[model samples]
Target chain A: MDTPLREPTYLILTALAREPMHGYAIIGEVAALSDGRLSLRPGTLYGALDRLTDAGLVELDREETVDGRLRRYYRLSPSGASILAAETERLRRNVEAATARLRARKAQALTPRTAGGLA
Target chain B: MNELERRYRRLLRAYPPDYRRERGDEIIGTYLDVAGPDRRWPSLAEAADLGRGGLRQRLRAAGATDLIPGVRLAGLLALTTAAFLAGFWVFAEQQLPPAEAGVPVFGPFVSVGIVAWCGWLIAALVVAVAPGRPARVAIGVALLMTAAVPAVSVLAGVPRPPLLVLAPMVALGVLALAVDDGLPVLARVLPVTAATVGGFLSYAMGVGAYWGAYRGGGGEFQPPIGTVLLLVVLLLAIGLGMRRDARGGWAAMALLTPVGLLNVHLLAGAVDGLASGAPRPTYPTMVGVALAVALLGPALLPAAVALRRRLGTPSAAAPCPTCGRHR
Candidate 1:
């Protein structure tokens, strides 16, 4: 079995899941998706990009020059898409189970006998 | 270049030369794109990332220096496992009276297994020296022999294989298939040292006769718990000292040997018990086998991915010897 994608890899794939993006665009999107929790520095982002490209999970889509700087676009490969989907499903199941348990605990707390203690 | 770009360019030297030639400009461009105009130097996180990224690339490049690290490591593992198995079979053949030993003993299967082992040993040696299509074919045939021994026996109406005997063969096939043949073959000295250490472990564990072939309640049945614990500790050390050793396959093979033994013990017990019309051993051993398989599952995939990158890289060579003569 393949190694499960790490948080950064997952986030990067998520960013590219919708459409191809340049390096800075991916960093911004990853941060936005995480609600400012993940701010990918260029070094980290490019390193990941290079590794991902090497692994065949991500590929360069196009390259254009903006303000005399190279802006290379990358998109998730088919394998990358499936990996992201599988990881998402796993996380969703975990969250669902945790929320279900929490809801059950809350319901138990709302029972009449438990409510009388607060009164 | 401006001062900040110049500084970043200097730091880029830490990356591999080939990598720098390919991706350096793009990296520099990305850094400039993200850098604030007021920023004078790289952030600590950025510097750390570059250091790590560069180091990772360098380490990978080192694998390509002489031998393809992936294939050679796989070859070493195949070689050592064959040697270990061959040595044990020799000992078991010399001693271990048949009356004391039961159906699932080494001597029963050793003949064909020895052939396989010898083939594997030769394949590994070939992989070490030749690094060509023939060596790869030899490795394939050797691994095939491992499964074929048991298979041919069954076709000849022999009793079903002691599953423990089968586990390592299965693992060898799986791992061998996972490692791409395109990677360089580096001859790491540590694997030899690790093999010596493994020999010590074999001697200490009474590896030839872990259980079976003894009077009464059978041979010394030291629970796999100790083996498992030691393997875990050794694995931890491997991880911690990864910097010391670039080829992770040695520790991996060392770990696989015992896990293979434990798996054999568990499955052999079950199969032999069933064949003899006795109750198969219990849950704990099954769980142990399951746990070992689980640990093995995660270890293989990522290494395959990494090695595939090394092997599949267009310029790693003029296409590995499969389609053409060896470079």
Candidate 2:
């Protein structure tokens, strides 16, 4: 892929990774998972779902109604799981690399110069 | 249904009929799921998002491009067209004295026209970036404002450009349906770029042809630039079509190849009329020339390319590609 998964796409797939969730549930779940960092509107969320479904990363799991509203549940497909895992690993590696560099810098800063007090 | 739900349903009709049929209820259900019972209307942000989304889907389904690319194409075309016009005026202002000039009338329109052109480019950017209903409307309005020059000129009996007329009309249609959505990037930009370049060059060269052919003032006037640009575009399109199965190539050809032919048609008629100091192509030969170019020119290139490709194929003797045999 020319680009990594966008934040919303990544989060949407993450929400479905746990279980099949309907539209409203996915919206709430994404918000909660992101600690309210991302709030997907209905239009934006649905458009993403369509794109994901078309790409075979997500698929409709079931349909139901609660309180007279149509609810179409979606789940991550096997391919989606594979993609999520790969993305997670990629993110983890990036995080680790940055953390390692920061730790090394901190240690270097704290270390006293052997030759002089302020070389 | 309550008033809000009914109103929302009306708004949802903006989506393509098939798309709305597929997911309209699901979308509406989502909207209501999130909305409070007391909420009477969708928020402006919500409406804009929905409008953009619907237009995006419609454009995606129709054009061979997605939303961003479509927007990019629109932004570029808008900017380019604006620049082309500005450059023309700059050239006119610099090269010729006010008392004697061969360019179109820019006298009264200089005030609003310049600002409108600037806003036109800005509106194009807005349409490209937002793709919302308001943005489209804004762009369309700006285009119409800039286009008022030609429109008024036509009403007051002055020569006007066809591109200025068609660009806004087509742009409005594109704004309504969207310019891009599901197609590839080139599928988005190629046809747009070709048409803009063709239009720009043709408009200039057509006027040039008119001036040179009839104005009793020509020691050395370069032949219409649009003619050469059209031939190059046509050949490039054919070459691409021959090499790869690309809708964009053919689409570009369809858009780009016509300008020079059109300019020829206009110039042919312009000469016959202007030489007599009458602004009508009344002669039969002039009418015939215009008719031939209008009828034959656009179709001729693609047909020729397709025919050449068909003939070049080694397996015409075999059964057809899809069916068992040719009819």
Candidate 3:
């Protein structure tokens, strides 16, 4: 993907990275992964899944019936995993740079001021 | 089905029937899994999301996967057409005989129209060079200036171009602003250059035709060869483009809509004149209707193609023989 992946897309991919999961399971995982900062509605989740599936970033893993209702499982593709890894690296580097800048600023602030001729 | 399931199903119906048939069960199942046992209705946010999703799916089903590309193409063609027409109109206005004495033909409205055309020309150049937000801003300004022509004319009681002519130019300007990013510089420049040359040729040919008629003692006027050649070239280009991509057809339609509108307006005027027993009774009602149908063809062709594609595809709408449920 040339453009940066959107937050929901990234979270969804991360949720699917561990194992193939059904729609509801992926939604729950995404919420947990985001620490409840984000919630995946069924419509929004399915829409992203459709786009990912079309882009070959995600694929149908299986379909089964539980409690007389159909459930379809989806898993991240190899391309999706590699993309996620690249995005993670990119974000990590950005965080490192920001952290270094903050550390330097703190060090500068904590430095002692030299006294003038009066001292 | 429970009340929640039933409501969710109702919301799911917003999708295209084929999509609903394939994904309805799965989508509803997901909603049911998420819903509490006692919950009876979908929350407002969920309903809104479902509605938006369904519309997006419908647009996808209609083969409008990404409208930006098509819109960009349309905008380029539309702006080119508007610039060419405006340039030609400005040139053609100069050919008219001067007004009698102090009674000016169009008064200050002509000057205003010229300024608007200049704005369009500048906007075209901006699109070729600057693009992005700059191009959009230029087009927006040009559109406003162009729209002001009729408004000023109406207020000042001066003759103005009919709304039929001015409307498409304004629409084209809006279309040009629909996307901020621009095409390649060559892509943007070539069309504008071609249109400028075409406009010049049209003006020269029109003047030559007028002079020829005047010199030949004026019987029936013949269509200018340049105009005929231009039309043929335009049709050929569109045909070749359509052979390559579907966007070409849409672009061609966008380019031709103004011409279509003008033709229809002219036809209506001729019909009215004939009914009122004017000197020339060339166009009949049948001819007008035929022209109207021809005008409608470009607009209808895509819808027809989309419908055919939808019906021709074997969808999951059919119920399974054994299970008696849609697959």
TM-score of chain B of each: 0.43, 0.45, 0.57
Q: Per-residue CA lDDT of candidate 2, range B1-327, in tens?
A: 777788778888777676676677888898887886998988888888789778756544443323244234334333333333333322222222234554454454322234454444455445444544655576566556655755665676653333322232333333223343333444434433443454455356545334323222111121233344346545655765686534335434443322423344345546665655534444454446545655664565347455654556333343321112331
Candidate 3 wrongly placed segments (more than 4 Å):
A1-52, A60-76, A79-119, B1-56, B62-72, B91-111, B129-148, B162-164, B167-182, B190-245, B250-256, B262-302, B314-327
Report residue A19 deviation for candidate 2 (angstroms): 3.8
TM-score of each prediction: 0.45, 0.54, 0.51
Show the colliding residue pairs in model 2.
Answer: B60-B181, B60-B182, B64-B183, B65-B181, B65-B183, B66-B181
The residue-by-residue lDDT of candidate 1 on B211-306, one tens digit each, is 343211111232243254335535644764575553454434434544444344445456446545543554565547545664765465356546
The CA lDDT at B193 in model 3 is: 84
Candidate 1 chain A — worst ten consecutive residues by lDDT sum?
A: A110-119
Instruction: Pick the winner on lDDT between candidates 2 and 3.
Output: 3
**lDDT of candidate 3 vs native?**
0.66
Sorted on lDDT, highest at the top, how do the candidates line up? 3, 1, 2
In model 2, where do residues sit more than 4 Å from their true spots? Answer: A6-8, A29-40, A85-119, B14-22, B43-78, B81-85, B96-113, B116-145, B150-327
Worst 10 residues of 3 chain A by lDDT: A1-10
lDDT: worst 10-residue window of model 2 chain B = B214-223
Best by DockQ: 2
| Residue range B1-327, candidate 3, lDDT tens digits | 887888999889888886777778988999899986889989999999899789767656655544334546667666766667666655544444334433334543333466777788888788888877788888899899888988887788765554544655665676667543636677678546855975686577677234223222111211122233237436645775666645544444444544444344334546656544432434354245335634574465467447745775332343421123454
